[model samples]
Target: MALNIKIHKADNRGKADYGWLKARYSFSFANYFDPLRERFGVLRVLNDDIIDGGGGFDTHPHNNMEIITIPLKGALEHRDSMGNSSVIREGEIQYMSAGIGVQHSERNFSDSEPINLLQLWIFPKTKNTKPLYDQINLEGKRIQNSIQTIVSPEGGKDIIKINQDAWLSLLNSDAGLKHKYELHKPDNGLFVFVIEGETVIGANIARHRDSVEIKGVEEITLTINAPSKLLLIEVPED
Candidate 1:
């Protein structure tokens, strides 16, 4: 099958701005709804949020969704019904499996600095299993100029596990660096989210906060034009 690529510009994403919080939704989230941008396969939600100091989401209920949070700027304090409480900051990733149901609250851990984070929700392969929470620090594990697996179904040394057959990787590349990513599983599609800097995938140019989705491709090459940080998510096409 031929590779099919779709580009989603950063400015095109759904936006919600409150007095204390500003968020950009890659998929349909909350009051921001776009029928064509609802989801890409099993990857449901990808939200880039900037929370003001001492502000955040209050305790909320979630069910049957695998939630993953990655802090980009500052720190976020997380508390859950399962008795899991921790401060997740930059270079760390947090996972929460809201199997049957779970309640949690996320607040800016700092009283003076705002927090920027990416929140993702993926569909689980099986429903109503059990709720779980854990976090991993990716400080020394991430590779420079290459892609590093941060989250996977089969958790291993330095990897966080989720309830779905998916893989989430991070990349930090210098200008002029070139890298190729091979699919970990067949029929899996890849979503590339540019967190910072600029890069070119095939013929498409993606700048900071832009995203590109590739399907039916076994491998994809990335060429960095400027120092860049990116997230690559591989998920089932169906």
Candidate 2:
């Protein structure tokens, strides 16, 4: 498969610590700029944010974009001007379509526990569709030895839908078994990111926080070496 790719090791990413919040940008942001690390495809930002107890970003404005928040650990109390307010904990996926305009804020509700979350921005297919907010809890998803669908268009099955055709999937290991993770979208490209543990993708090896983009490959196969967690994004190659 001929695919453009980038690998962000856990230690080599751009890190910024601001007392109450610590963040690592997989791609450059604000004053940080790396010509080779701007973004991947329509994926603009992949921010791993760790917010201290009762700390988070205040009201923020965004437009013409799709913002997705995936909490890896702890919980995030979210409030938007669209009349949506909720606590998104681990196993929950949240999406906000800042189509025309949207104002929102995120904060950790716990007084002593920190929150680890992933904030991702994706370019939407349609412009100015209207501001929206939605969240899905995937506590009932099951994928014995493969990846589970967490986000997709139209909120298909057990996935949280976004405004784009892109899809996000997660894989959690069951045991010491070789697993096959397949991307059904052959015309689209697959961005595979390992969240934890080690897994073999095709002939390449990927460890925690590492990723590989595979295009033109009809399917992908993963050999889970241990109890692993993975995230896969399928988006149009164009």
Candidate 3:
């Protein structure tokens, strides 16, 4: 049997309020550290950030990793050293491959509206490929009663592609709807993050900011209790 570890709904996640930026992390990061909770599998970081109007993170450098950005509300203005500058709105996802090294900046485009986004970083199998940028939009489509799929490995109809053997699925779910995720490839595992509302995973319940790590299972089920949203990442278990 595979291991089933469920993280319950709790307010124990580390929080940092900078007035302009409000972030809640499930794992200890930077100034926030919980010896019990750090990271899971190849999924290293999950930062739920809310940037205030006209506020954003300045240029930063990253290397030898896959960085994904998903904006849930408002628009984000992005500029990279690779000469990629664009505006990402809700329903859109951006994937940046920091293979060697890259410098970038992210800012909320609206002066009166803040931007809510989730930034994820995954460790790559091999480092130093090449720095790249791409994005995809998922709008007006329902997947298992939800709306989301901004990134995938196979490069869906309009999704951005990454080098790693991983996939990201987002859903805006309806109550009573159950969604099952079956393993698509061997040596892979799934990480589920609750973005909004409430949901039940296996025999446990998870609320906002709660997460669960499942491995060696052929498939798992999810039941939404209300109109909710969530992110599912499928990556190598090892």
Best by lDDT: 1
Writing each residue's lDDT as its tens digit, candidate 2 over 90-163 gives 98899898999999999997989999988888888899989988888887665656667877877866577788
RMSD to truth, every model: 0.8, 1.9, 1.9
Relative to the true structure, how large is the alpha-carbon lDDT of every model?
A: 0.94, 0.81, 0.82
Off by over 4 Å in 1: none
Model 3 clashing residue pairs (backbone)? 146-172, 147-172
lDDT (C-alpha) at residue 39 in model 2: 69
Task: For model 1, state the Cα shift of residue 153 in Å.
Answer: 1.0
- Given candidate 2, what's the lDDT at residue 238? 61
Decide which is better by TM-score, 2 or 3: 3
Cα error, candidate 3, residue 89 (Å): 0.8
Clashes counted in candidate 1 amount to 0
lDDT of 2 at 210: 79
Report the lDDT tens digits of candidate 1 across residue range 1-238.
Answer: 6879989999999999998999999999999999999998899999999999989999999999999999999999999999998999999999999999999999999988999999999999899989999899988777898789988998988888889989999999999989999999888999999999999998999999999999988899999999999999999988
State in Å the error of residue 160, model 2.
Answer: 1.7
TM-score of model 2 (CA atoms) = 0.91
